[model samples]
Target: MTDVTLIFADLAGAAPLVMVLLGAAVFAMSRVSHDPRRMVRVLIAIGILLFVRLSFPLVIPLLLNDVIGAREVQVRVLWNALFYSVPNSIALGLLFWTIFDVGRARSAEEMTRA
Candidate 1:
């Protein structure tokens, strides 16, 4: 492997550790939270992130070779798209969910106070 590939492998190897740390933090926070459903959402988000992280190693190797057919190329393209889109979609979903959740909680607090 070249220097860049070695660096890439090292970084990829660390992805799981980062994910686990994130999971641990989420677990700790969820324990203190009153809403169990929030914990569920967070777990789901973490699962999605883990899936994307694990798929990273396979994606490059799977797409690196030459393709001889239109169908094969299309299939590879779809896999690449799926791999890339999943993480992005999860992130956007979490972003919106967090914003909406915070807004709803604030509104509820104000209503209760009033």
Candidate 2:
């Protein structure tokens, strides 16, 4: 395979390990009964963030090669900013909200040991 393919291959190869790590994170989060709803929100949002990151190297290259008209780097850049960055930013925002939840200080208090 070509070098470009190798690069994507590397990303694909590492995906399973990353997925396992994320799965462990989700499992750990599941054990937290103090704030199940918010904890799930945090995990789901983080998982989306990770999924988008993982899909990018594999999907964008393929899209540029066969599906999309634009070239690889340029189109992926614009697409990254549009499709990828948006959701990524939103995921981060949701994660922040789920963790802090300014309007729900009482819920945050449930997490305290005191």
Candidate 3:
């Protein structure tokens, strides 16, 4: 294998590690309280992960010549799907959360008014 191929394999090998870290970050963010600090952190983390995830497929092919490596091709495909799917799913989730939060806030206001 050429030097370039070695580098490509190295990066492809690391993709799973990056994805696992992203997943862990999301899981940790989900546990955070509704405080503004926590929310900001979560949003920032999500944004960064989303950007990276979206770009990974594009970068992967550039890093490798075959674009169909034995071990990592499936990962590339899955990430490509996830890159397209996550934004809409996350938007829906946030929308639901917002609706629930607003409803609760309004209910609390009504209780205070009573």
Candidate 4:
């Protein structure tokens, strides 16, 4: 890939990072029960993880270009893809589950308050 492509990728990553920062700020300002706060924290974590995970692929081309054999590059990319995908899927899934289950927590809180 050209340097121009790398520049574009870098530019693309900025917005998500900004959004994640904004989410962090919102999380800080939130006043909620412990369980709801936990859900917000998980959401913030997922956002940061997403920004890092998506931005990571850009590093490979810059780091490995002409540094190794094609076969080695393939192996590394495969390993990176596996390393990249599985953990992200697991984390994202769990975070989404937490977000979905927030209603249960809210309902329990309501029950206690009543």
Q: Which candidate number has the best TM-score?
A: 2
Q: Give candidate 2 misplaced runs (Cα > 4 Å).
A: 1-5, 9-31, 72-76, 107-114
Error of 3 at 71 (Å): 13
State the lDDT of candidate 4 residue by residue for 58-99, as single tens digits: 755554555543347677677668656776677677667766
lDDT sort, best first: 2, 4, 1, 3
Candidate 4, superposed: residue stretches over 4 Å from native? 1-21, 28-37, 40-44, 47-58, 62-77, 100-114
Return the lDDT, model 1, position 18: 67
Tens digits of lDDT, candidate 2, 20-96: 75885667586667667777777777687677767766666566567665666676678657876787788888778
Clashing pairs in 2: none
Q: What ranking of all candidate models by TM-score puts the best one first?
A: 2, 1, 4, 3
**List of clashing residue pairs for candidate 3:** none
RMSD of each: 5.8, 3.9, 9.8, 4.8
Score each candidate by Cα lDDT: 0.61, 0.71, 0.58, 0.62
Q: Which candidate do you rate higher for lDDT, 1 or 2?
A: 2
lDDT of 3 by residue, 1-114 (tens): 236666556668767866785786677577555445545545565565556555554565554446545357677667557655676467446545744665446456766765
TM-score for all predictions? Answer: 0.51, 0.66, 0.30, 0.49
Off by over 4 Å in 3: 1-54, 60-79, 107-114
Of the pair 1 and 4, which is ahead by TM-score? 1
lDDT tens per residue, model 1, 2-111: 24586478567867676785875577475745555665666666666665665555544444443322246677677667767868598659746954796446456766
Worst-scoring 10-residue span by lDDT in model 4: 62-71
RMSD of 3: 9.8
For model 1, the stretches where C-alpha displacement exceeds 4 angstroms are 1-13, 16-33, 63-82, 102-114
